[model samples]
Every structure is written in C-alpha cells, then in structure tokens.
Target: MFLNHGSFGACPAPVFEAYQRFQRELERQPVEFLALERRLPELLDAARERLAAYVGASPANLAFTTNASSALNAVARSLDLGPGDEVLLGDAEYGGMQILWAYVAERTGATLVHRPFAELAPGPRTRVVFCSHVEWTSGRVNDVAALCRLAREAGALSIVDGAHAPGQIDLDLEALGADVYTGNCHKWLCNLRPSAFLYARPEVQDMIEPLVISWDFHAPSFPERHRWQGTINPCAYLTTPAAIDFQAKHDWPTVRRRCHDLLAAAELGLEPLTDDYVQMRGFRLEHPDPPELKRRLYEEHRIEVPVFESAQGWVLRVSVQGYNDEADLEALRVALAAEL
Candidate 1:
C-alpha cells in the first residue's frame, strides 16, 4: 500500500483518462495544438478559468507553469533585489526552494535570512517574506494570511509557497492577500505531473516577468506574457479542468475528511511531532537509521512511507489518502514495530 502521497500524489482514474485524451489529441494534431491553432487560446483560457475558480482567484491574475519550482523561479528572478536587501524565509521551507533562493541571493547580492520558525517579523531591509502554507517536512500549517499581513505592514512583498495546500485545504487567494502565490496542481488537485500555477495580485502582476522570453514577451497582459512558454506540451494544463470535475464528482471534501480522520487515528498510539496536518502526519522516531527503516518496511511488509532526518529529529511521515484504509495503517504499524 502507498502512503507517500505528500511526496507525489496519485491521480484519480478519471483524471488520468482525461490527461491521456488530451495527450492523444495533441499527438494527432501537433501543429494545430501547439502552433497554428485558433482554438488553443480558448482551451487554455477555459482551463485557467476553472483553476482560478477552484483557487478563488481572478482568471486574469493566475498563470500556469510546469510546477511550483518553475513558478517560484519566475517570481524570484523577476524581483529587483540588490545588496543590503533581505529575503526572509522559514527553516521549514522546501530544500529545493532554499537552493533556488540561495542562487537568487548570490546573483542579486540580496541576503537570505532563515527563521527557525515559520513566523517572521520583517525588518526595514526585508524586501520579500517567503514561506510555505503547509510545511513539507513537519506538516505544520502556518497562518499564511497573517504572515502576508505582517509583510504588508513591514512594506515587503509576500511570496507564499502553497505546494501542499491546494486539495488538502480550502484556499481563497484573494482572502490570503499574498503578493505572489505558487502551488502545485499535481500534488493534491489530482492533476497530471508538472501542472501548477502562479498567482500575482493584479497590482503586482507587472512585477513578475516570464522565466523564458517567448512569443508572448510583447503581450499586453501579465498572464499572456507568462502562460505560453515556447512550444511545449500543454496537455497537463489542459487536463486540469477534467481533474477538478473528477474531484467534484467524487466529493473530494468528504474524501479529505475521511483521510484526515484516518491520519488522526493512525497517529494516536505514536503521537506525531505535529498535529497540524490534514492528511499527512509526522511522528518522531528514535531509530537512528530512518532510510533503512523506510526500505525495510517496503521490502518486508510492502508498505510505502517516508522516513528521513530533519532539524527536529528523525521523522516517519505517514500519508492517508482516499485509497488508504485501516488495513494499510495496521500493516504500517506492524512493520514499524518490527523495524524501529
């Protein structure tokens, strides 16, 4: 049984079928789908509209990227940072994102400050406050709206990395009030791999330029400039509407509630390090070798989960999804008892 949905989410059968259909259509008429097409824009717009409604953002304010990393790169590279400027971030931020910001800091002479906790009070030199809505490592959910407000009060831009929040929680981008927000559709929205979005408040949209200078470089609108990045397959982006439809048909909210309950129940005996997660729970492990424990669990019990060392301690993270059941949890408990 699979329990690592946080690492890579599994697509529903209907969504996968829809993704295949889009891919087949693209293969049938490559030129029409990619270049010489009159309908491509409409198709993209419709997909974006559906996604925007799902995320509670204006269609004009949202743009599709391959994933959260790409979307974040677009935001990071576009910002005019210089020496003496500070970019505040949390220690719980994704390691890949930390690398991206480090590179940005090196290039622009900006200082990158890492806070031990998610909460931050930006200083005078702080240009941007970057943090995650749902921390990947600890599964801690932060008060993102309040963080954004703090950034605004300090006269700094707020960039929220919401890669883990989309389907796990109800998000209203407008209500959040972050200047820039990036999220992955594949992680929780059940969309195809590499499907994600970036939202910039209308006032700040012009501040973000496309990562790749493409045909839309001269486009008048912000989304138009960033949407079409060269002649790449946009099937994943096109299939998002179908993914949303599939979630609606399956009553994903109830499914999520059930998953949360499962996670809570599973974490009962082994109290998790943090109780802030919706579907994923993280518990401390006294075991010295987390990787070995993970491997043994999979090899011996056919259980799949994530166990790794973090700043907090060695952690074993269990993810509960709609497909998971009590049997899966029981198997994991037995395996962990044997290995750890």
Candidate 2:
C-alpha cells in the first residue's frame, strides 16, 4: 500500500488509460502522427491554453521540455556570462542543476556562487539567482516573494527551480514573477515521465534558446522556435492537460490536506527537517542504519521511497501525493518502529 503513490508518482486510472490510448493510436497510424506538423500549430495551441490555465500564464509565454533539468540547462548555458559575472544560487538546489551551471561557467569564466542559506538578501553583481521553491532534501519551502523582491532590488535575474512546489501547492506564475521558472508535470501532476515546462516573461524569452535547435531556427514566432524542437516521443508532453484534469476531477486539494495531517501525526519522533513545509516531509533517522533500510522497504515491505545523505544530515523523504492514504504513512511509521 505504501507503493500506491509518490516515488515515480501514481497515475490516475483515467490518465494512464488515456496515455495507452494515445500510444495505440500512434502505433496504428505512425504516418499520421509524423505528419501532424501541418496541423501542429493548432494542437500545440490547445496544449498551451490548458497549460497556461493550469499555471496562470499567458498561453503564448510557455514552452515544453522533457524535464526540468533540460530547461534549466538551456537557460543556464544561454545566459551571456563571462569573467566576473556571478550566478548566485542557494546551496539547497537540486544537484543536477549545480552540475549544469558549473559546466557552463567553466567555458564562460562566470563563477557559480553558492549563497549561504541565511543570506537570502539580494545584492549587486549577482547575475542570476537560481533557486528551488522547495528544497528536495529537507522539504523546506523558501520565501520566494522575498527572494524575488531582493533579486529585483539588486538587478539579479531570478531563475526558480520549482520541481516539487507546483502540484504540491497552488502556483500563480505572475505572482512568483521570476525571470525563468521551470517545473515537472511528471513529479507531482501524475503525467507520464519526462513532461515538464519552462516559463519566461516575454522580455526574457529571447535569451533562452531551445535546448535542441531545429526547424524553427529562422521563425521569429514563440511556438515556432519552441514547440517542435526535435523528433521524439511527444505523448507525455501532450498528455499534461489530461493529468491536470484528472487532479481536478478527484478534488486533490482535499486529498493534500488529509495527507498533510497524516504526515504531521507520523513526524512525532522522526525529527522533521521543516516545521513549516508540510507537503514533502523529511526526517532524520535516530541511528546510523545501513543502506538496507531503504532496500528492505522495497524488498520486504513493498514500499518505494527515497533516503539520501545531505549536508545537514541523512534524510528519509516522503512525497504525499493524492493517491496516497493514511495507511501508507502508517506502514512507513510501523517499518521505522521496527528498523530504527
């Protein structure tokens, strides 16, 4: 039962069924799917409309990507950074993004500044402040409004990595107002794997080139340059609207509240990292348990969860998505009782 949600994320029966239907249709008419470009504009337009509605952006202002990492890499590499240029970021960001920025900085001579967690203040010479809305290890949601305001005051461009915040909480893109914001539908929205999005305010959109250069090289149009970057599986990208609809159909806000309550009860002895961020709860184990704790959960307990080492401590992270119930959390609680 602990495997019912989170981890790879539990797809609702309807969305999974819809995805299978799309796959069958593609297999049945490969030629037609390939030839969809003449009408691609319309299909993508529909996707944009649904995406914009879900995230509160103008339909014309978003682009699709396989995942959040790809989007972050594109933005990081495209920025015109050189010697003395500094990209400020919180130490708590996802590891993959840190590597991407380091690679870009190596060639361009820009330094990647790891800002102290307490120095959330904005300052001059900070070219880009890349941040995660919620820390992956600790589940501590940042004060984005405060950070963005500081970025604005100091002339730094804000790039938010929102991989865990979107479906876990309500998002108003304009209200967040970062120069670049990227997130994953696959993580919490229950879309198929490799579905994510990048949103840039219209003025800064030109600075982020597509990760793969393709047919839209000469076209000045937004969708032209972004929507059809390459030839690959677009099933996941196209089905995000279905995932969004599935969440609404199930009344997910109520589900999230119930999950939060269950987690609050379970965190009594576990020492949660965040007293405030309640969606993805992280706890410090009381003993130096072997890696077997993670393996045994899957091998014997039929549970799939994540436990990783961080700078502050070892963390057992659990994401409570809509499909999860109190029983799943209870199972983990019982397992901890036995193991630790």
Pick by lDDT: which candidate is best?
Answer: 1
TM-score of each: 0.96, 0.93
Clash count list over all predictions = 0, 0
Q: Please list all clashing residue pairs in model 2, or write none if there are none.
A: none
Report the Cα lDDT for candidate 1.
0.86
Q: Give the range where candidate 1 is weakest over 10 consecutive residues by summed lDDT.
A: 266-275
Superpose all Cα atoms of candidate 2 onto the true structure and report the RMSD in Å to 1 decimal. Answer: 2.0
Which portions of model 1 show Cα errors greater than 4 Å?
267-271
Error of 2 at 81 (Å): 0.9
- Leading candidate by TM-score: 1
Deviation (Å) of 125 in candidate 2? 1.4
Q: Candidate 2 lDDT, tens digit per residue, 214-319? A: 7776668655577667677777777888989988987888877877777777743588888667567777865667477888877888777787777656778887
